[model samples]
Target: MNGTGRIQVARKVVGVGSVGTRAWVLLMDTLNGVEPLFLQAKEAQPSVLAEYCGRSQYANQGERVVTGQHLMQAQSDIFLGWTRARGDDGVDRDSYLRQLRDWKFSAPIEQMIPEGMTFYARMCGWTLARAHARSGDRVALAAYLGGSNAFDEAIADFAETYADQNERDYAAFQAAVDDGTAQATTEI
Candidate 1:
């Protein structure tokens, strides 16, 4: 972005859940300020669920994320990549980069109409089924899911229980931090 572009700026991105740091980067051509490219960088860390799911084969945590995205989505962002860099504290970190919005749309859930929410739910189900079909045995999926809502309800129940456990764990961690037994750093 030197002679080709004028200056590149990085803006802090908020609201997104990340294990570590996240930011939005903008690159623009200084000459006309017309050529603009927006990129998102998110820190990658070892997954908390990895212990139960099994060890990842990717050397870098970023690669694990990239691979999972590719497998779960029919189409992935064109500018997806991964890199490692040394932080100011002399610690190496892994991060993944992708276009901020390649072909995406979003709307507040609170603003969605009932009909629209139903349609959206159907679409989400279809997309998840497709992803499972691509990565798992179709015959087995058909057999497991069957022709009823039993499997779906079971999955929902499991998710609720899992979330309750996670909340308990988080509360314990917060108590430790409050008691000065553990330190929680919110900003870097």
Candidate 2:
């Protein structure tokens, strides 16, 4: 941002994954007031796996996000950073900030055919492998995996069980909504 323009900060309440997390967008005009630089800050909380996986070495969840991004990604956002802030509620929260070049993008899974879905699934597998290759101890992982398909089979089994549980959870939520135990709202 440059010149005499002002920055505006707005809360983004919709479409962000995992509802109830605080997300904010900051817009600052560059040069004149026409071109705007967009930065977004999202609340970072402790991992859901913390109970079994222990705690993150980084006390600040924001710093943990930044560090994990740097480790698992080849190229990070230009202004990727982190901070801990005490809000009006007097509670401190860790948040990761990044230049919001794009709001977000996703594949049109609804329109994909079986073949396209297979390809998409393979692509996702490769991407996850790449991230793990970058972050994990490759030698140790190779030693554990060896030249066998046992690890692959075990992983597939776990994934299937996980997906099954997700489906059950979703069904439960739907039942709750239908019975008036939970409320559903539409955006816009």
lDDT score, candidate 1, position 139: 93
Candidate 2 local lDDT, 78-122, one digit each (tens): 789999988779999999999866446668999999999999989
Output the worst ten-in-a-row residue range by lDDT, candidate 2.
12-21
| Model 2 residue pairs with clashes | none
Candidate 2 wrongly placed segments (more than 4 Å): 1-4, 14-21, 46-59, 89-92, 101-104, 165-188
lDDT of 1 by residue, 1-188 (tens): 55766756675655647524655575655577776677777778877788999878888888888888888778888888888877678998887889877777765678999999988878877888799787778898798789999988998899799999999999999999999999999898
Candidate 2 residue 7 Cα shift, in angstroms, is 1.1
Candidate 1 lowest-lDDT run of ten: 19-28
Question: What total of clashing residue pairs does each candidate reach?
Answer: 0, 0
Off by over 4 Å in 1: 1-3, 6-11, 24-33, 107-116, 147-149, 152-188
